[model samples]
Target: MIPVTRRIAIDERELSETFVRASGPGGQNVNKVSTAVELRFDVAGSPNLPEEVRQRLARLAGRRLTLDGVLVLRADRFRTQERNREDALERLLGLIREAAVPPPPPRKATKPTRSSQIKRVDEKKRRGNVKGLRRGRIDHD
Candidate 1:
């Protein structure tokens, strides 16, 4: 079991990893070795995740979540397959941990202070006055 939080633990079997060839500069070795790791987690079908976390995970997953509800994380920063695999697993754990946290309390709506409102009005009036002064003088002929 992978411990995401005090209350949330994920089964190792729940995760699946696939190795693929990494793109970008790694000399000729990159072509020969499949160093990139694609980690997949079934967010929609997983019984391990709480409903709230699942919803949050879906939101956070964004494009990473497929139509099948699998969360895919690709790791290819490292040159070696082992490092990439570890990176992918670490990233998966990080995402799960993030989802496990509760959302922050909503911010309380606040009205502008009387002094600030007055200041704002004063500034607007001052700006209006400046613009008003820009008007050309009228001819009294």
Candidate 2:
């Protein structure tokens, strides 16, 4: 089980992992050994997550989430499969933990103060008057 928070624990069985060859740093060993870890979790079907967390997780996953609602994380930073696997699991846990937090309340609408409105108008008028002064006065016949 992976504990995300005091109230949320994800079952280990929910995670699926696959090994694939990684592209960098291993040299000859890279061609022979599969070091990359692909971790997949079904966010939409997980019984461990609350509805709110599930929704947030989906949004947070973005392009990482498949059409089937599975969250895919690829870990190839490490040259060893074990480290890559751990990295993938850690990333998944971090994402779930982030989703567990509640969103902030919406901001209330506010109107400008009467004094501020007056100040804005005054500034506009002052600017216009300064520009108007740049014009040459016309002589009356």
Candidate 3:
């Protein structure tokens, strides 16, 4: 099981891992060995996650989620599959952990303060005056 937070957990079976060749740092072995980890998790239809969490996860997942609602993460920074696998799981947990907390309360609607409005007007007037002064002197009528 993967623990997202104290309240949220996911089954390890929910995650799918595929290994492929990793580019960079391994020389010829890089081309031959499949060490990169491609981790996929289905967020939409998963039974483990709450509806609200699923919704948040979908929106928060960005380009990582495929059209079929599978969350895809590529872990190639490390050379070994085990390291890459852990890295992928860490990223998944990080993402889920970020979304575990409730969002901030909506701000109350507010009108502009009279003093602030007046200040804004005064600043605009000052700016206009500065701009107006830049014009060359007008010819006598």
Candidate 4:
């Protein structure tokens, strides 16, 4: 089991991994070896995730998530398959941990203080006066 949080633990069997060829850093092995790891987690079907967490995970997954609600992560930053696999797993866990955090409460609508509003108007009037001074004087002979 992979413990995401004190309340959330994910079963290892819930995850699926696929190995594919990665294009980077491994001169000869890059072409022959499948070093990239593709990790998939079914957020929709998982019994471990709460409904709210599942929804947040889907939102956070964005394009990486399939229409069927599976989260996909591709890791090819490393040359070795083991490193790539671990990288993918770490990324998946990080995403889950992020999703687990509750969103901050919505900000309440607030009116500007009376003094601030007066100050803003005063500044605008002052700016207008300064610009008005910059204008050339017209003669009335």
In terms of lDDT, which candidate is stronger, 3 or 4? 4
RMSD of each: 5.4, 4.6, 5.2, 4.4
- Clashing residue pair totals per candidate (backbone < 3 A): 0, 0, 0, 0
- Rate residue 11 of model 3 by lDDT: 93
Each prediction's whole-model lDDT (CA): 0.91, 0.92, 0.88, 0.91
What are the clashing pairs of model 4?
none
The top-ranked prediction according to lDDT is 2
lDDT of 2 by residue, 33-73 (tens): 99999999999999999999999999999999999999999
lDDT of 2 at 127: 73
Better of 3 and 4 by TM-score: 4
lDDT of 4: 0.91
TM-score for candidate 2:
0.77
Q: Where does the lowest 10-residue lDDT sum fall in candidate 1?
A: 132-141
> Candidate 1 clashing pairs?
none
Clashing pairs in 2: none
lDDT of 3 by residue, 1-141 (tens): 777888789998899999999877888889898999999999986898888888888889999999999999999998888999999999999888877777999999999999999999988877777766678533322
lDDT of 4 at 5: 91
